[model samples]
Target: MQAYQVAELTPGLGADERREFRDRALSSARNPSQFTQLREIEGYGEARLSLIERYLLQGTPDASALAAREAVALSAQASQYAKAMEGRYVAALLLMRRVLLGTALVTGLLSVTSALRALLLWRSEMDRRARREARQREALSLASHELRRPLQSLLLASDLLRHAETQEQRTHLLALIEDGAAQLASRADLTRLNDLYLDVTLRPRAQDLRPLLERFAAPRVELSLPLEPLVWPVDGDRLRQIVENLVENALKYTDGPVEVALREVGSQPEVTVRDHGSGLSDTLHGQVFLPYDQGPRGLRGGQGLGLPLVRRYARAHGGDVTLAAAPGGGLQATVRLGQPAGTRAETQAAGGAGLLQARSDAG
Candidate 1:
């Protein structure tokens, strides 16, 4: 059943009572029975009710025109609010899209970079392993080659000694045995020398360089050691090895008297071994330190490990060994030992020269 829907218009109604009456009318708009009952109220004349009646029910041209204008303006205002909410939704969606795209891009880049880094590291490790294997093979080959001649000589000497005819023959056979044994001893020394180069824990201690030099020098060799004790950091056994190698190399190759000198150069302690025979050409000087590389002057049968070992030992001490043409002729071998602090950094730049290559790169 239809009910009148006009808001109660009472002359004695308070503001609160009027608001409550209007709310009741709006709440019942879906039910025509409520509006039908309210419309039949005798003298109700609320403005909202008049607009509704004129626009919807009465259908008078002038009243409808007024109601239509009011309804159109209110609809436009409501549409503006709805459009604002729709714009906010669109903006929020675009922002979310941008965030998702950026996250995806960053994640992709990071993944690619990580994969690339891992591949590069793996390749480097593989290359290092290959080089190490190659070096090991070369060392074995060198060892076999070195040991072969001596081994043959020892075997021959043993056979001859067993069937010796006289004391002289036996003595000669024994000398051959001694030479073979010496060759084997030299091979063992070479192995020890390699170990010395690779040893990182070889600590240098303060030592007097003058006496060390003099001890290795023969009486015939001229010594120009510093009058003031050239005290420097050195490993005693290694220093002796360096001195003996240099002195021996000098005397072995040259006809003239060998000169041994020790002096301080900057923070480094320098030892110079000079001989007065024809020196090597410029090109040979650089290669003289390379393993198994003997210069043009060194054509005679000799294992070419001496200069290389000297260089390796000197470098291991955080210093360097250099060979140059001496003034007035012959070759000069100079050895420099670094201060302890400088050695740590040199060990970094040594370029895969010993066991330190792995440890330094890892650091």
Candidate 2:
């Protein structure tokens, strides 16, 4: 409309027409708000937009055409920038989704693994407790059965004593009663051995072990010891019990003479009781050390508490007991005692000659 107005105008044009054209041109120019919006974009071709703004203000036909071309170029540049930013935003969203998925998967696996491990531990503990309780029940049953026989014999012998006719008859009845009472006492001691040992503190003092072993020497049992004195700090009563139990256990299974050797190994006193009989199998060896566990032999008229008590007594004196197969096809039970300082000479002095002296002494 401005170009048409410029072409049709004559020098004699009215003042009102010129004033209306000027007002329309000003209204058609770019608004200040459009310039503010274009400037706000990050890379909206600022140089070209400024040139277009300057051309619009000139208000000539040629300048208006140039400004329109610059405006088109600015719009295309803004569109390209928008497309590139859109692609980057989409890629970032995908990366974030993958990270969240991986974290969730790892968390779930950790929770499952912890739950399974806890369940396995709980199951193992329950199984162990069940086995212990069962063993305890069996021990109680066996004890009751063993005690009944002696109790019945005692009752019968007591009734028989009341009706005795002569001196011989009374003596026989008394002997039977005495034997039954002794058996009952022995059984009671074996049954309470663990508790008794646990409660009793060891009273260790320096004592000779030769005399103690000599007391146990018999036709079926032989001894080897240092002739001078197998002196060691020990609880005499407990040490005696340890020797007696080993010897008795040896004799129970073997017909040949049992060998008892007292020697020193590495500054410690070691007593080994060996029998030339059928030794225990590998599996039975461990079982025999458990209370009331007789392994394959069951109970051969003896409580299965001896070896366990032997170990307990040994450990009380800061020692331990180990059983292994003897060189000549039997079981060898060894008692090792913890020696204090200044006992190395006595222990190492246990030479081969002690076997001859031990035999001579036994004879």
Candidate 3:
């Protein structure tokens, strides 16, 4: 009966079907001995098993192991990517926190600096206002003192002229009255007041020099000639004021004679007022030219504006005024003005005239 059953099974399966069954058994086995056991099965032929090992199992072990290892490596790489994404998110959060803090610190510093700048500006403005007020007060005080002297002189002269007796004495009194009236008239002239302020404050303009000097020169003060006329572009009115002020100052401060000399120095013409008064102190020399600056302590009744005005006028003319100890023991003030724009012949002529005047004054 067993032999009959085997023959029936063997006869039912074809050769190709038998070979496919052997290959499946070999592929499913975990070890070489498991394939050997499958080969010993009753219907499995040794020849079919040998064909499976040669065609299917041969050269396939290494390929199968490599495929399994690649799957495991892919899983590990996915796990590492997940961890890296988490780390990057944490780092981004830390950077964002630092940026926010830095912005706040910078904003606070800027606010403090702006406040300090505003405080400094306010303090500076307050200081300027205080200084301006002080200057105005000083100016008013000096103007009042100056006005008082001239008013008193006019009143005294008027009173004297009213009571004169003899004709000769009346004539002399009339002359004094005329002098006082002229002085009063000068004080009343608004133009003179404007000029007085301008001389010390404003810039000078080009003007004729000869007529300007002539207008202010005292009638008693004589001038010499250089045989040729000279011309210059200068601040005429300011120059006149400076000359008049210096001459008047010389007459007021000293008992000896005074002289004014004009000469040409290269392309510039210079006016020098020399007086036999006590010279300025070496220590106070530079200070004398500043506005509101006073001379020596002993020089009374002077408001200390004369030399400063002269300096301002000189500067306006693009020139300067200097003080020196004169050879005759007095003050020598030299005011230099640049030569005017004109023909060479005209400039020479003007220079000659200035030279003549200088010689006349020197004599």
Candidate 4:
């Protein structure tokens, strides 16, 4: 209505007012033909048709009224477009919300499942660690117990040495002191034996075991080996430890010569350490391999680690060590290495578990 009033007042306007109106209206538009100021209005159907007819018929258009009608039509059209755009925006927002809610639900489920798996793994690791720590403490306790006797003997012998009246008694006390000191040194070796024989790696190579056995031979030990090399894929140093422990045990038990023999029987290399003294009892065959499992008091003194370490080292290198009665008398300690199945990488990869795994296989 106001646009119509303006159209009517336009005919009465001075030239300056008309110029100002045209300038303001055309300012936002490029030119008359390109200008999009007017829009088609659906509700003004009859009036728009009448204007179109009048535009076709009239020689010159009633410009002010046409501009006013176009303005009114364009305003109505713009209002309808705004309403349609608002509806589209609201629909898009609802779709996005549903998608976001589904994504969040899936992510939450994944997180929960992952947390449960991680919890189970952590619990298993903690249990394994606890068991390992318990075994270590038990070993330390056994070593401490073994060390005590040798230490007490050393102190007692030194006191006796100082108070001895006869040179013969003093000499005997000095011998006792020497023996006790040697016992302490040998027993101390057991403390560090864990890293090599138990829960550790041993890099075995194809080498001769005969020279190693012969090298440990002494005037008191009757060494017997063939003139040829007794070669086997064995951890030589650890194998030497096994030979030394067996020979030392033999010499310690008997005053007579201890016999040490090395020979290959069939596919396996065999070692026999024989002493002319009472062998371990039949009941003690299995018991002897345990840590700090000392025999009957005063039979033979030891930290009791020799047999166990011997067995462990032998087993770790895919072999076995067993104690049994000798041919004529005394205990016979034998060692044999297991045949290689694969490579050294597989051995080290197993750490100490390979020893038990192989023993289980042998059994």
Candidate 5:
């Protein structure tokens, strides 16, 4: 007989099954031989049976039998506790999965929103560029119209002067014609200006800074340079205009000497123009580069286009210009541009002689 057979044979084994099985086996015993036979069956301990018999017939159950019942009860309680713990673990796993799913959804939404914002910003930038180009074309057209009228007048005046009868009348007509021609020449050609502007704004060309600086160094203004040549990709005409404007402005601000210098600052080329005159005011330093901006004293001679043009030209070359107090209590304008990629040997070997000659003439 096994534990299963003992369980099946026990009467009312549902409540206190182990104890009921023990009591039933002991109660049916008639003699020691019967008790020993009952003990021979599985799960029927001799000590347990004797204790049950004593408890039922003699009113004295052993301590060992009571301890066994307590152990069985404890095992049942532990099993129930294990089932409860398993349910809680499953619930926690489900909650964690739900939290992770929500986080993933939020991250996806944020990525989508960021992408949309970038698209909108790109569209806005494109629109702004289109508008700026349109405005630039309009300005060029207006300048062309203004320039053509004076040029036509000068041409007609010259034709009339060439065909004049009296020497005195001819002389007067010639003077008038010369005046008209000078006026026309003073105004810049819209096409050339526009072309230069495009070159500065769009495709910049490689230029030798040393030669460019040398070209602008007039006898009226003192100039300085480094021993080595500095080169960069830049708009040549725009850079010329910037240098011219700075020099002209310096001339205007001071009857004293004006100095210009070019040097390499780390990986870039730097151009500095210094004028020894009454320095610019702290308030006017930042505003001087703005279009139509006059200085604090309202220097009335100019149309206030010089510094503004210089600023525009510098910016177009992917560089910046700044005004500061010079070492000798004067105004200093500095322009910085990215350096060209080449060593001296490579530059010399690659037919740089012709370029150097051309640059010398241009300077």
Candidate 6:
């Protein structure tokens, strides 16, 4: 269009000026295309400008008339190209806006999901903590109550010993005092064991368990063995405690004899203590294994830590303790020890003193 206007106003330009204008216009027309219509406009306009240049050189009316006619056609093409480009630009802007909206929706949904998951986890953790705290409080209360009886017995015996009048009376009072003192010492040992059982590690060694089992045998307790040194990797002191607690617990509830048996069940060592008295119900049996939960028959003269300690010590050796009703009429308690016992001891906390190498000579 500029070239057409220039030709109409100044058709008599110098030869050099006309050549320069023609070169500049042709160079722009040969450049790369942005749109098809834009390319077409440049090509068509270049041809019309070349025709006008020819008219300037020839100074003829026919050449001028042809240049004028081509000018009108070039103008119409430019108008259409402008409107087409505007419509394309609007369509591109709308597509970009839709893409942004979709991205925002997906991001919002993810944020809401993450927040809800965190809230649910927090509530679950809080509920678990509350139950644990309640259990601890109940256990502490039961322990305090159990300690009072032994303490009162000690105090009463000591008071009666001071008031004795005769030698015989003094001897009876002294025996009472000794008994009370023994009870207090036993209670103290149980309390200490309860605290250490979970935290302390096991000190297992390869040794015969027959001698240990023999220590508990008496007229009231029948012993069954395999007629060989039942050797296994075990913490002797812990095993002794386990047997003692179960035997004493049985004696406390029943007057009949208790049977203590030792043998290997599969690769693990097993100890079964069966009492010939009426066994506990299924519900009470389960409750007695919980710390300080002695059921309705609250562990006659016991702190209710016996079964719990037995189970914990057994588990520390990577084994477990189970209680079931015997076929005839009794509660059979079984304690199983883990295979390759030294492996589990490495992962647990350091335990109490090591067991003495000397086995008990008592039968």
Q: Pick the candidate with the highest lDDT.
A: 2
What range of 10 consecutive residues in model 6 has the weakest lDDT sum?
A: 354-363
Instruction: List, in order, the clash count of every candidate structure.
Output: 11, 0, 3, 0, 1, 1
Candidate 4 Cα misplacement greater than 4 A, ranges? 1-130, 137-195, 298-301, 340-363
Q: Considering only N, C-alpha and C atoms within 3 Å, which residue pairs clash in candidate 6?
A: 201-349
Overall lDDT per candidate, in order of appearance = 0.65, 0.70, 0.59, 0.66, 0.64, 0.68
Tell me the tens digit of each residue's lDDT in model 3 across 1-363.
Answer: 122223325767765664564445445433446433333341322233334334334435443333334334433444555566679889988976775565565566566557658878999999999987775554454344344544775677668768877788878767766755655554345445443444343433333355555544555454432343445555454576578667766766677777777766785778888888888877767888766666765345667777776776677666788888899699888888753233335547676665455444534
Relative to the true structure, candidate 1 reaches a TM of: 0.44
* 1-363 per-residue lDDT for model 6 (tens digits): 257336545868876775565455444434435335555565544444445445545544465456555555656667666666679888978975775565565566566557658878999999999987775554454345434555776788778878878999988878766755655554345445344344446667757788779878788999998775666667776787788788988887689999999997895579999987778888777788887777466777677777887897788877899999998998999998874346545323433112222222211
Return the TM-score for each candidate structure: 0.44, 0.43, 0.46, 0.45, 0.44, 0.45
Worst 10 residues of 2 by lDDT: 339-348
Off by over 4 Å in 2: 1-195, 339-363
For candidate 3, the lDDT comes to 0.59
Over 1-363, each residue of candidate 1 has an lDDT whose tens digit, in order, gives 011112232366675665564444334433546433333331222234445443544434454455545444544545555676689999989986775675575567567557768989999999999988876665554555446556887999999999999999999999979977876665545556345443323556556667667755566588887666565556765676677667777877877799988887884578899988788889888887777776776635656766776776687777888888998889899998875434455545654263233324323
Residue by residue across 1-363, what tens digits does model 5's lDDT show?
Answer: 124234645676774775565555454432446433333332322233344334444322343345345334434545555676679899988976775675575566567567768989999999999988876864554345335545676788788877889999888877767755654554454555554433334345556677667756666788898765555666565576678778878888888888999887876788999999899877788899775576876664665666766776676666789999998699999988642232334445766664465456545
lDDT of 2 by residue, 140-256 (tens): 544454456568879998998999999999998898788678667754575563343543356565666777777667788888887666566777766876887788788888889
What candidate 6 gets wrong by more than 4 Å, as runs, is: 1-195, 340-363
